[model samples]
Target: MPNRTAVHSELYSPDSADNPSLNGGRCRSCGYVFFPPQRYGCESCGAPPEKLEAVQLGGRGTLHSYATVHLHMGRDIEAPFTIGLIVLDDGPAISSTLANRTDEGLAIGDRMKSVLVTASTDQAGNEMVELRFAKAEGSK
Candidate 1:
């Protein structure tokens, strides 16, 4: 069995899988949503600093843009990997790997859903997690 504590520490620390889904900072006073989780005053309507709150976002989205990477920093991340910008159904867009498929038949405007996946092993031999998108069940 995997060491749960080590796995959690490696995969769930800071910003990888702890929150799994993307989040935004919402202005409590004006309901403005800021992607990348703002820590200061609101960008919309200039709300005061005290009104910001972390909001969990739904990970369902559509493919906005994509690219098939054949090469990466010395790691050779497997050829024909599809990386895409997913525009969340209710919030901002994020860049993530499109899971369970190669780039051969992928196209823009494809619908996808976010999923947490084991990315790889770290230098310490612990598992790492990352967010990825995949075709929704029954999607063409």
Candidate 2:
């Protein structure tokens, strides 16, 4: 097996491909959960930065909305990709790139789950995996 690494090590775990989780922060005072793990302060309770603690948020969610991108100016990802707005089962809503290139068989209320997909290979022969959301099996 080739070497594998996460595209964003700060966002998700590089290991645990079978059960992926996002690096999220929770406020100890007010019990608010947020993604992207911020250390500034709790948005819900105005607690200090010390009140925030890192937590693992599950990668299961419901698709709230989605859009297909036909125009992109970034070199990281090509155009004709799909982005989905998912309301996570834990608490936060995150916008993740869909595994499918297009939104052919997607719906607003469909169940979605996180998946690791190969984005590119580095010069060192490491497979760079990116966390993406895909329509869950047997979900409508």
Candidate 3:
């Protein structure tokens, strides 16, 4: 059993605590892919709600954009993190935290891969895992 649970059941794939893939929705009608597994109709083409199908991303993406965080923003999360917008191989761009936060070491077009990381802890002290993008080895 996974120690972590996605807000929605279809949000993650291989549905395990270890190295689960991000489950995105692809619009069969308009080819729009979304990270939240689009249960709603496509806003672009007004495709019927059911047109969205769940697809497992390859877990690899190219860094399209990024922002370095400096404030905690009243959240439980820490500061000095990197938030990246990555274009996945499967055609959807998703936002995730980067394992490496330093701007000096990160660059646009760098290859990133999804990996399980701790989001926080539960009242029971169990870790909550979430997907994060990290610099792939040999990918500068």
Q: Candidate 2: misplaced stretches above 4 Å?
A: none
List pairs with backbone clashes in candidate 2: none
lDDT of 1 by residue, 17-126 (tens): 33255666688888876666756798878888888987777767788888887666656356658888888877677787778546766678888886666667666765
Q: What TM-score against the true fold does each predicted structure earn?
A: 0.71, 0.95, 0.82
Q: Mark the 10 consecutive residues where model 3 has the least summed lDDT.
A: 1-10
Q: Candidate 3: misplaced stretches above 4 Å?
A: 1-10, 13-19, 123-125
Please rank every candidate by TM-score, starting with the best: 2, 3, 1
**Clash totals in order:** 0, 0, 0
Model 2: how far residue 5 lies from native, Å: 1.3
Per-residue accuracy of model 2 over 1-140 as CA lDDT, tens digit each? 78889989899976766549999999999999999898899999999999999999999999999999999999988989999999999999999999999999999999999988888899989898899998988896
Ranking by lDDT: 2, 3, 1
lDDT of 3 at 60: 82
lDDT, each prediction: 0.67, 0.92, 0.75
Best by lDDT: 2
